[model samples]
Target: MSWTVWTYVVYLLVTVPLTVWVARTLSRNGKVFLEDVFAGNDRLAEAVNTLLVVGFYLLNLGFVSLFLRVDSTVVDVAGVFEQLSVKVGVVALVLGVLHFFNVYVFSAIRRRSRTEARRGAPMPPQAQVAAYGPVPPYAAPYPAPGR
Candidate 1:
């Protein structure tokens, strides 16, 4: 086989498994976090976890496939290695970015949920105004003629 074909082979061999491993790891570990975030809703947590894993697979695989093509011809073993390194490096970076993004989003959701739980159910707008009472009109420092 040609060096270009070898480069593609090596790239796929490294990236595909790496993607699967990372996705599985995230899904396995994220379940507990999701459960907590969803306030012990196991069904919802599992459903969201599955959806996240599916999304992760779609994004990583799409990136890997899109990046598989080499711009230049790979002539030898060194060239193949060099090409593979660049491709794999880019794939790794993309994966890391995606991972961090997912973490940030979930963290934000978790934080919001925790805050809401602490605050309990929100009061309606009318109830809020009633609870606080009506605002009095501003009064001048000096009294009127009547004193």
Candidate 2:
């Protein structure tokens, strides 16, 4: 087999497993996070988790397939290594981006949920302050020449 073929094979071997591992890890660990974000709704958490996993797979695999094409001919082992490195590195970066995005979104949701939970009912002011009339403008360091 030519170097391009070898590169494709190795790239698939690395990226597919890496994607699978990441998806599994995220799904496993993200359950608790999702639960918290959903305010302990287990069924909702599980459903969201499943949907996220499916979307992850579809996006990652689609990207992998689209990015599999080698721009230049791979003539030797070095070429294969070079191509594989770029491809796999890009895939890893993409995965990291996706992971971080999900975390950020869910973390925001969790924060909002927690904040809402904490704010049960509005409380009256501890002490009321009388409104003062609008204050006059502050004097300048030096009086205006025309003053």
Candidate 3:
């Protein structure tokens, strides 16, 4: 019945499942681009997924712990709910923004990789700008056969 208890319940109720949902959605939607971003390495994608989940847990836990420590000193259920709602709402917003940032960054990386791939491969040594002059055919004498 205490406000602290309610605050905790709401915090967990909202944060845990939401984070899982976002991570799932991201992993699913980002699959198409992940291959390009990290060279189709499933292991890298798994690592990224693990890292993201860990980071999400740490950040959301920090937010919950900090939110619970507010100095208001008020013990009313209403006050607790009000502050908890605001805190959880802010956390949701932050998660959304972070999700978008993750997607955008990876998308950019993927685009850069694709661009690099699409560009013609490295020029052969002989075709480089420094070697533009017409080369004598392989059959030509190395030094005017008379030499």
Candidate 4:
């Protein structure tokens, strides 16, 4: 096989496994966060987590396949390595960006949920403002030195 073919093969071998590992890690480590984000609704959290993993797999694998082409001919082992570096580097960067984006979104959800939870039923007015005038004067318990 040509060096270009070899490069393609190696790229697939590296990127696919890396994608799988990242997805698995995210799913596993993200469960608790998701649950909190969903306000401790485990079932909902699990369902959403599964969907996210599926989407992640679809998006990344599709990207890998679509990006597999080597625009220039790979004539040597160095060329193969160079192409692999660029391709794999792009994939890794994409994964990192996606991971951080997911974290940011879920973190926002979690924060909102906690904020709502903290804001329980509004407290009754502690004391109603009888009027809006500032004509009150201090009446000391004991008359001033010489009232």
lDDT of each: 0.91, 0.92, 0.73, 0.92
Candidates by TM-score, descending order: 4, 2, 1, 3
Model 1 ranges off by over 4 Å: 121-147
Candidate 2 positional error at 58, Å: 0.3
lDDT of 3 by residue, 52-88 (tens): 7678677766765666555565388788778777877
Candidate 1 lDDT, tens digit per residue, 1-147?
898998999999999999999999999999999998889999999999999999999989999999999999999999988998888999999989998998898899999988887887767899987998865679566778876
lDDT-superior candidate, 1 or 3:
1
Model 4: residue 147 alpha-carbon error in angstroms: 12
- lDDT for each residue of candidate 2 in 44-143, tens digit (9 for 90 to 100): 9999999999999999999999999999999998899899889999999999999999999999999998899988785445422224444457946677
Task: Indicate the residue-level lDDT of 42 in model 1.
Answer: 100
Tell me how far candidate 4 lies from the true structure as C-alpha RMSD in angstroms.
5.1
User: Model 3's lDDT to the true fold?
Assistant: 0.73
